[model samples]
Target chain A: MSDARTALYDDHLAFGARMVPFGGFEMPVSYAGILREHDAVRHRAGLFDLSHMAQYHLEGPGVGHWADALTVNDVATMKPGQARYNIFTNDAGGCHDDVLFYRLDENRWLLVVNAGNAAKMWPYLVARADGRRDVKITSGHGSRALVAVQGPLATEIVAQLVDADITVMKYYTCVETHVCGVPAIVARTGYTGEDGFEIFVDSDAASELWRNLFERGSRFGLEPAGLGARDVLRLEAGMPLYGHELDESISPVAGGQRWAVKTRKAAFRGRDAIVAELEADTHDRIAGIVLDGRVPARDGYAVYVGDERVGTVRSGSMAPSVENKNIATVLVTKAASVLGGSLDVEIRGTRHRATVVALPFYKRPTP
Target chain B: MAQPAGLLYSKEHEWLKVEGDTATVGITDYAQNSLGDIVFVELPRIGAALKQHANIGVVESVKAVSDLFTPAGGEVVEVNAALEADPALVNRDAFGDGWLYKIKIDASSMPDALLGPDDYEKLVATS
Candidate 1:
């Protein structure tokens, strides 16, 4: 509870935002209202302060080999200025953390780690530096703050605001450009399943950039979204949250992150254990459910089938923008993983019935 | 911030409008404004008896769930069924169309506990 607050504390107080502790930081859960901010990200764009996340730059020869062995994604083939969402797993195939790897050039890469486990992932990567004479490890340096602007109109609004030409940056790509006179890097990757960009800049200048974004994007219905809306939006997008879906205790095979696992090549840290688990048929799987009604089957609620308890819901919400129903991701036993399996969430001393459904309760219209 | 001239509000933010033996109870305009979105409203059944400041129902927002307590003791005469189907009405109109329930109140205890408009406004300003 005594964790140091961020630089945006004053801004949050001025905006009358309700602050709550998350990942040990006093972060805003909502401002201007939850549904109002939620709809803004879904319909327009949202400005999220991602300053809590940790970033690092890796350089020198054979960095690709180090990255390829460190993460579950195919980072060796990443072209210069390209970014790929990746996952790092333990020897038991359990994910240590999920990260985004950005290729700066040959033998140089930038990685963004989760807030809580940023320091934890650093040692894991450093220990696996494949035959490197020197590997630079810098965590939380130079106020490497980031802002995620996500929605259908995010690109258009950001392009209008930043001096950089953000038009040509393809999805999962990064470009070193000046945004609003601040030297920054804009990456076309985000948690919400929409056309968006994540901008990285200095901390002292981030608030100004954020204020500028809101001022310019106000005409397009942009709102300052908080962690509350961010959670629901990511859930609706079926994107796996770090603590909910990936943690040190849960293996990637069970966390529904096999797409990021590259087991076809030489063995990585978690490759052996992942192969063994994939061959076996005992591990639990993550499943999505759209509850029968608007009442959410929140975190830690039980998931059941008639008289049998099968799983527990990790993250859930009654989506605000569209589908306005309770949707949750559940860690279910293998037998209860079927789509038609019925379930119920015990909320407020009442059991609300639900049904197992497909993922991505919401997605942007294809352009 | 609007506190109707005639209505009495509770410290917990519930408002009551007494008309003869019946009292209409709902959260105040300030309460709804602070709560952001009203996603689900769970109201008590008609004919249920309740005590003053007792838990009558629950309201679920996207962020959290809050318990709803009544300001005065009464027997539920009628519950707002429209709110159960569309809870957003509470956000759109917290006082008029969003009135939660109508209770035939115990007329004797009604006048002493409720806060007047000026008092409720001052209470919230300090909070």
Candidate 2:
């Protein structure tokens, strides 16, 4: 199959972005460079084209109930204009996909899922909705486009393009408003650790929105960031990527997302399996490792202690923001997850010492 | 991309400046630009012997990691110590201060396949 392109493909090209294939889409990996782009998001503001993320709209009577049954998050408790991070678990208790549940109204809902999992998630949702007559699930995959403005100044910059007052918009909330005269859903949510807003608009108006945001955001130092910067930012923030940290074989609970799983609530797909794992003490857990040198412990590299293979690295990098630290997220045995425990990562056939550090290597100072 | 005159280049994108038996080695402008924002560089130990086109070290950028291949067989005499603190020199001055190492070339073992600037320019253009 041919790789897909986002609505802002031309815009990325105009910006001289290096394109790479990601999630079956030809996406921009970097613009000025990953280091500069990553620094911009942490120090100032950075714009990102997130149009490839899958969007599904579900509305009708009992929609919230249906969504609650399918997702691990407590959907029924979410107020209008609120969004909650959730996970769709298979019957085996492994994560089908990590999703964002946007409660538009009492009966209307929108689910934003990872780009790679869109096809699988769509069919899975359809199969679950087979006997249900009240909820309607509509795919908005290629029809909508998403642009995120993230950083310390993201709110101030995005406020200039939108009609609504977003300065007071709390995190994880959204409002349907007009951005640069284009109808959009302005949400105070982002993957970066910094404060930000994600604006969702029609695909056709994406370029206009991007241009206007760039023009208005120029004074605020808003540069166009790419997936390369986004990856490091999310990793530093301790958020897990789907194929890396949470996969079809990994449960969200083991992936350090137990907060999203409402175990006390009624039964959901994979709830029993997840609960069973939680009851067991032998489940592997996700932990952060700080390597001794600059050589990163890449994915699939084995984690060791003495002669024992304890785990494997999920994501690793020479963190751009943190000086002299090579950070990695590893899936290790529960016993090896103790904070400050020493371990070894075999990088390219060489053993490197690593320490079990805190999950988030970086955190934004709350203002 | 700038390919300095009088420097011998390899198909692997490494450039070598030969002076007597010692040669200074670094990647080319095309190589550094393609790698993008080199954050770390691992160099070979002084006195270590290497074969032509052998993996001598590694260069890491924010986007990915690439192996640095030796252009000619030699024994490492010295390595650029500045890269330990700031690896961006590889992106800024890949042909000069970014030189990875200096090696005493083995006169009898020098590879015959090294490309001149013009030939390397053509090679890079087609690639």
Candidate 3:
């Protein structure tokens, strides 16, 4: 099947973005350049078009209770205007998707899932919601557009177009407000690990919102970034990518997200399996690795300790923020994931020395 | 786009500048642009013998890696040392400072398959 295009397709073309097929959609992989755009988001501000992700709207008094039973996090306890990270798991404790829940109001909530998982998640939700009249699930995949501005200067850029005093909004909070003269859901949340805002607006308003933000943000050195840079940024920040870090076959505990698993809850999907894995504590887990050389470790590269093969690289990149060295996440044996452990990544039949380090190879400076 | 004049080109997007018996080899502008944000370049060792159109090295960008081929065969005289410290030189100046290596080869020894600037431009246009 042909790939679908987002509302900002024309705008991306005009900006000279390099488009690639991702998650069944035609999306930009880079604009000016991957490294250039990455640097912009680190020191200045960078804008992104994330409309490919699927946003599902849940409403009615049963929404919270319904979501709480499906996800690992406590959706029922989330206050209005708060955003929480969650994971849906199968009976085997494998993750279906890692998503974010935005509580817009007491009875209204937005669940954002990965673009690649939209097809699976939509059907899964529909089948589960059958015969439940009090709960409703609506798909906003193509009708809504998501634009994110991320960096140290992101606040200055977003505050200009937003009608509300977004400066007062804390991290992981959302508010319904007007931006660029159109209705939008402004959230102080991002995947880049930078201080940023994600704006959700109608499809028709995406072009104006992107153009206005670009024009005004130019003075603050805002450049258009694409998925290539976004991948590098998120990796450096230690944020998990759905396909790489979390997948249908990988449990959250093994994906280095044990904190998100609230097994103490009365009941939830995969609760028994998750609790069993937690108690076992023998499963291979995700761990960070920094190569000792310049050659990049790519996904699926073999990782070894001496002669024994331990794991494969789940995600890898040349991280500019982490001393401009190569960083990667490997799903490795429990013994091999110990901090400061010595490991080698075999690239093209050559073993390069590496160190098992902590997650978050780079962290933003606190002001 | 038209290729730089006075250079022989390969179908693999390598450009060759012959100066007497020594030829300087580098990737074409089209090749560099397509690779995007080169982070590392693995050039063949100096003094190594290579065949025409032989896979000599590798050029890696942020997202992918591409093989580097030589347009002509010769003894490797020198490799660009600047690339070791800064591989993005290829992205900035593919035909200038980004030249990969030097080979001791006669101009007449170059394979007949090597295209001239006009022919290379045509190849790029159709690509």
**Which candidate wins on lDDT?**
3
lDDT of candidate 1 over A1-367, digit per residue (tens): 3755665667777778888877657788898887778788888888787777777878777677766776677888889989998888788888888889888777667789887886577677676664567555556533677888888889877997666678888899998778889888889999877789998887888888888887888788888888888888888888888889778878877888777787885867788888988899688888888888767677888887777888888998887644587788999998888887788777777778888877767878887
Off by over 4 Å in 3: B106-109
lDDT for predicted candidate 2 compared with the true structure: 0.89
Q: Is candidate 1 or candidate 2 better by DockQ?
A: 2
DockQ of each: 0.65, 0.74, 0.85
Fnat value of model 1: 0.80
TM-score of chain A of each: 0.94, 0.98, 0.99
Query: What clash pairs does model 3 have?
Result: none
Shift of residue A208 alpha carbon in model 3, Å: 0.5
Model 3 lDDT tens row, A1-367: 9999999999999999999999989999999999999999999999999999999999889988888898888898999999999999998889999999999998899899999999999999999888898789999999999999999999999997899999999999999999988999999999997999999999999999999999989999999999999999999999999989999888999998888988878898888988888888999899999999999999999999999999999999899899889999999999999999999999988999999999888899998
Tens digits of lDDT, candidate 2, A1-367: 9889999999999999999988778899999988889889998999999989998988878777777777788987889999889988888988889989888777888889999998898898888777778988898898999999999989888887889999989999988889999888889999988899999999999999999889888798889999999999999999999998998889998898988889987888888888899898589989999998767788889999989999999998878666747899999999899999999999778999999998788899989
TM-score of 3: 0.97
Extract clashing residue pairs from model 1: none
Worst 10 residues of 3 chain A by lDDT: A257-266
lDDT of 3 by residue, B1-127 (tens): 6678989888999999989888999999999998899999999899998888788889999899799887888899999999999999999999899999999984555656888999888888888
